[model samples]
Target: MHRVIAKLAGLTLLMLSALPSRAEEARQFRLSVPAEVAESGLMDYLLPRFALKTSRRAELVGGGAADAVISADPQAGTAVMARAGTVYALRLTGENAAARRFADWLSSDVGQRTIAAFEPEQGAPFAAARQQQAGPAPALDGDPALGREVALRHCARCHRTHDDDRSSGIGSTPSFPALRALPDWADRFTAFYVLNPHPAFLRVEGISPPFDPTRPPAIIPVELTLEEAEALMAYAASVAPADLGAEIVHQ
Candidate 1:
């Protein structure tokens, strides 16, 4: 029994010693994205969130030195059934632990949802590692009128809430009607607040429409409960054009 315990302790020490010894490398996590995709603003939104969730300091690398690389399935075009996206862990230097944690998180429900929510201008929803049918839609219990009121009060400053009520929102932000026009808008709305960019930019005290440059920036995204999100979806749907065309998913 004593011999077995001694052997186990030696084995443990051997494994620890085998691990990479660069303290700086262990503290830094690096991810590489395809160049075209990197330019779409999606990775800008996602990579920071990845670091935040996994408690790591992540850096984006050009192509190599990546703890993980985000790539499309090579057989996607040729194979009838191919993965939507694949994450490759390079096990570079001393980043194995950080790499594994980020990869695991990417496959989690929250991570997959966030990944799918980012509709990059250059591509479609990401092929998540764990692909599952979306869960049942959240109940829309709040009043549509109340939802519109909420939008006018909170979202109008940044998003175009109505066709007539334009020229008020941030120039770059999408109009609510435009967003609802998408075929999968319903699903997208379900996870919007929990996804990147939204998580970073939304504030509880929604800035008023017509930019006031003088006010100090507010923290916390325009606060909307699940109930409010449901109502907002309903209101946006009501205003959306009946014949809005299908949007193409970028490859």
Candidate 2:
């Protein structure tokens, strides 16, 4: 009888311990930011406000490039903030349908309000463009060569194109060592590029075009039409490494 009683007590204690952990998990919400934005220290300014507005316990995690927020017990509420573009509802709970509805609403008016509040100087064209869905689209001609050409012409200025160099490697200029490597690279590049164009990258080391923050954001002036961009994206999707390909899909 004593042994059975001890076992029952142990089970009770175990259940008690699990309750808090399960509650914590249910309340937790994670926010992930790309590496470039984190480097710029944008999260330092943005996160506190979000925590305060949502009345949630927030912790910032991950130091290198990516920034993430683990919010515990987020209050059911909505708030808005603006920067490069308007961000509506700083705390979005993936599990809550109401949070999603609020996000959609904020994506329109409140998003505009937030943008106007933070970056008043940015032009309308850039603002509107940023809000649009910028993910990879369907291909134009289904031609890998054409995609390579588009990448070389538009992206080669900042990224390495060949397989030889010091940055990526000896001949690794930013273009594909294999098409499978593209999805994650594309995801990282797109996230950073859409958020903000790096002015410092305009001029290669020893090259001209003095870095200027005041200049309008550099638009990649798509030489390829939407269809071509899609085709290039498909080509990129085909050859990236397996793990990177999964990350790209997640991003």
Candidate 3:
């Protein structure tokens, strides 16, 4: 009889302990950001939109108890975004699907656009930070021929990869050569997988995180291995930048 009572007490304690966890699950996610960001009202504008899109609620918490913290400290974790020239990293200390969802949202097209659009009083809008790179960009190590073929297959549908392929590509999209003309073109292409539109449909095998089920691609999805993306970059680099220069003079 005593053993039965002890067993019942233990079970009751277990049930009571699980109650908080169930409550936490209902709350979804708890995130931490710098006080400056909270004060700037970016969260007020961002959270509702996030909830509407992902059907998840993210609550703000103090640093110690947060599932994730957006910090300027690189040692904290991986850099995810930048605001006003300050790079912020995502430091995830605990596991929560909603927390991961919020992180993905922060780096997604909508999140980036929202962050960039928010104009804080007397503050610069947030910007998408580039992928971390050490020193100058290395020289191309791919075959121009192979790069061209890769580019033709993957990129040409929306970008003119060559002068002979002028009939191809959407009018609104910039041509490969035009994009190559920009000084930061390499960086842009390197980070394309994580940026808007691409993240919706493009999966990079083992490199990219799995797509969120709550927000699947509206169009056909595309998958690429890291090697393929690299080859595409090599091909883009091979293109001659358009010489946008001197005005014509009629004598």
Question: Who wins the TM-score comparison?
Answer: 3
CA shift of 222, model 3, Å? 1.5
Q: Which is superior by lDDT, 1 or 2?
A: 1
Lowest-lDDT window of 10 residues in candidate 2?
121-130
Model 1 stretches astray by more than 4 angstroms: 1-137, 201-221, 242-251
Candidate numbers sorted by lDDT from highest down: 3, 1, 2
Write candidate 1's Cα lDDT for 65-170 as tens digits. 7766665433221111011222222223333677667666666667666765676664334434232222223444557897898789887878888888856799
Poorly placed runs, candidate 2 (over 4 Å): 1-47, 51-129, 133-136, 139-141, 164-215, 238-251
Judging by lDDT against the true structure, name the best candidate: 3
lDDT (Cα, 0-100) at 74 in candidate 3? 43
Query: What pairs collide in candidate 1?
Result: 202-220, 202-221, 202-222, 203-220, 203-221, 203-222
Error of 1 at 3 (Å): 32
Instruction: Compose the digit string of candidate 2's lDDT tens values, residues 108-181.
Output: 55434333334322222112112222133232246767766766676566554444423532243334543235
| TM-score against truth, every candidate | 0.43, 0.33, 0.52
Clashes of each: 6, 28, 0
Q: lDDT per model, in order?
A: 0.57, 0.40, 0.70
Candidate 2 lDDT score at position 24: 52
